[model samples]
Target chain A: MSVPFYDSGVASGLLSGILFGYVLEAAGFGSARKLTGQFSLKDWSVFKVMFTAVLVAAVGLYLLRLGGMIAGNSVYIPTLYLWAMAAGGLLIGAGFAMGGYCPGTSLVGIVSGRVDAVVFVVGMIVGTMAFAGVYEPIQGFYFAAKGPDAQRLPDLLGLPEWLILAVLIVVAIAGFVLGSRLERARGGPFTAEDVNGEDTSKAKNQNTTFNTEAGIVP
Target chain B: MTSSPRPFWPPLVAGAALGIALLISFLITGHGLGASGFVTRLSAQISGWLAPDLTTANAYFGPFLTAGAPLASWITWEVIGVLIGGYVGARTAGRSRLMVERGPQASVGQRFAFAFIGGALVGIGGRLARGCTSGLGLSGGATLAVAGFVFLAGFFIAGFVVSALVRRAWQ
Candidate 1:
C-alpha cells in the first residue's frame, strides 16, 4: 500500500518540494508585485490561492486521519508559543510588506532571474545569522507562553475537529466573496496579462489609477 | 523575448495543485511544506564551519549541529527541489529574465535596500516563529494549529499597516 520511496526522507522531500515550487511559480507568486497585491487590495490571487490551498490540505488531511490511512500524530504540528508566534508574525508581516516577498516566494523569485530576490535571499541569511548571534538575549521572549505540545485549534477551542473544519470552510468561502468585491471596488481582478510579458503598459496604467484612488500619489 | 510569455495558471487551479502537493508531502514525509528551516540550517552549518566555537556556543545555531549535516536534512533537499522546480516553471513559461522588480517611482537602489532589509526581518521573524509563510502559515494552518492562525493574523494585520506606509516601494 505504501510507496517504498516515501519512507526515504530525502526522496520524498525533493518530490514534494518540486511540486510545491512549481505550483508557486505557476501561480505567479514568483513576482513580488503580484504577491504584495494582496495588501493593496488590487489583486486577490494571493488570498484566493492561499486560502484554497489551506482548505484543500486541511480537509484532505482530516479525511486521511479519519480513514486511518495516516496516523494523527504522524503529521508535524508546531508547538504553540503565543507571544513568540505573534511577535514573529508581526515582524514577518512587516518584512513581507516592505520586501514584497516571503521566504518561499523569494526562492521562486530567484529562479525567475530576479536580482532583487537574490539580494533578499542574501539578506535573509544575514538576518538568520543575526538572530543566532542575539539568541541568548531574547531566549525568554522567544519561548514565552509555551502551550501544549502540538496543540491544534480544536484542542484549544474544545470543539470537534469536523465542526471547526466546516466553520472554516464557510469562513473561507465568505472571505473569497469579500475578496472579489474588494477587487471589484479597487478596479478589477488582476489577470495574467498584467504580468505575462513586457506588455505591462496597460497594467501599469491601471495601477496608477488604483494608487490614485487609494490616495497614494505614485 | 519575441513571443508573449505564457500566462500563469488560474489561482484556484494552482492552489489545488499546491494543496495536493502538500497532502502528498504529509502522506510521505509525515510533514507539510517548508522553506525557512532550510535557510536556517544552511546558515548554521556555514557559520559552524567558519567559527565552530561561536556557532556551537550560541543558543540558536548550536542546536542545528546536533542534527548532523545540514545539507543532508529533509528540508535541505526539499529547498533544492524548490530551486529546480522554480527554474523549470519559469523557463517553461518564458518568464525567466534578469531584472529588478520595483515600482516605477522607486529607484533601483531603493528596491534593493528594501528587499534586503525586508528579507533580514523575515529571517529574524521566521526564526523566532520557527516557521515562515509556508512552514507556519500554510502547513500549520492546514493542521489547524493555533500557532498557525495566530501567526497569520499578525502577518496580515502588520502587512496591511506596513504596506500602506511603504506603498511607494511597490505601488
Candidate 2:
C-alpha cells in the first residue's frame, strides 16, 4: 500500500509524468505524422499502444485491488457527466485529428523540437482561456446529464470485474490481430523515419525502396 | 549531430511500460496520469494575474484561483517532468529537430494554422470533459469509469470522421 519513495504527491507526479512522457516519445507518439497515421489506417501504433496500456493498467489495478494493496476508494475516478463528456470527446477528437496532437502528445511534440507543437500549445492555452471566458453561458451544458459519482462499467453492466476485464482483454487481442493485418495490407509497420518525415528527398536519391505513395519505406 | 532517428519501440512494449508507469502512479498518488489540468491551471493563473477580480468571480477560473498558486499544483510539476522526459527521450533517440512537421503537400502556414485551431478545440473540449486523453482516457479508462469509456468512443469516432474530411492535411 505504501510506496515509500514516491509517497508524496509531488514526487509521484514528477516520476509518473516522466515515465509516461518517455514511453510516449519512444513509441513515436511525439510525431504528428506518426500519431495521425491512425486516422489514415497507415499505422496502428496509437491504437495498439493505447489499448495495451489500458489493458495492463486495468488488469493490474484489479489485481492490486483484490490483493488489498490499494484501497477501493483511494484511486480517484473521474465523475461522469454524460453530456459534457460526450460533447467534449467529439471536440477533442476533431482537434486531435486536425492538430495531430493531444495535450500530452503536444508536450512531447514540443520537447521533440517541433515548431508546430509550440503553436499548438499556445492554441491550447488560448482555447482554455476561451473556455473560462464563456464558462457562465455554457455552465449548464457542462454539468448536464451527470451520472453517479465514480460510475464504472462493471456496475452499469452488472457484471463481475474479472469478467469485464476478460472481455476487454479478448477484445484488445482481436483488435491487435486485425490491426496488424491492416498494417501489412497497407505496406505499413512504418518506422520512425517514415512517420517522422525524415529527409525523404535524400532517401529517395539514394535509390532506397521508399514508397512515397504508401508513405512506408522499408 | 545529424544522426538518423532510432526506430520506435514495439507498440506493445511501449504500452506495457506506460501502463506500468500508470500503475505506479496509482500506487503512489492514488490517481492516474494527466496533462490538460496543468494547462487549465496555468491559464487560470495567467487570467487571475491579468484580471484578478473578474477571474475570481468566474465559475470556472474562480475555483482555480481560490485553490492557491496554480503553478504549485501536482499536475503542474508532472507536466514539467513530461517536458524534461520528452526532451531526454527525443535526444537519446536522435529524434529532436526544429522543424514544422506536416504532410508533403501542406505548407508550413497551413500546418501552423491547423495546429493552432486543433489545439484551441482541444483546450475547450478538455475543459468541458473535465479531462483529456491522459486524464480521462488512460487513467479513468483503467478504472472502468463510464465517463472514460464514453469519452474514448466519442473521441475516436469524431477523430476518424474529421480526419477523413481533412485527409489532405495529413495524406
**Best-fitting candidate, scored by DockQ:** 2
Question: If candidate 1 were superposed on the true structure by all CA atoms, what would the RMSD be?
Answer: 4.6
Clashing pairs in 1: none
Q: Where is model 1 chain B poorest over a 10-residue stretch in terms of lDDT? A: B1-10
Instruction: Quantify all predictions' global Cα lDDT against the true fold.
Output: 0.86, 0.88
Candidate 1 predicts chain B with a TM-score of 0.95
Query: Model 1 compared with the native: what TM-score?
Result: 0.91
Worst 10-residue lDDT window for candidate 2 chain B reads B1-10
Model 1's DockQ?
A: 0.70
TM-score of chain B of 2: 0.96
lDDT of 1 by residue, A1-218 (tens): 74212454777778988999999999989888888889998877888898889889999988888887777777889998999899889999999899889999999999998899989988889999999999889989988999999999999999999999999888878888898889878864544445544445654555644544333342
Per-residue alpha-carbon lDDT of model 2 for A1-218, expressed as tens digits?
25313354677778888998899999998999888888888888888999899889999988877887766777889889999999999999999999989999999999998999999989999999999999899889999999999999998999999999999999889988998888888867667777554665675566465556444445
The chain A TM-scores for the candidates, taken one by one, are: 0.86, 0.89
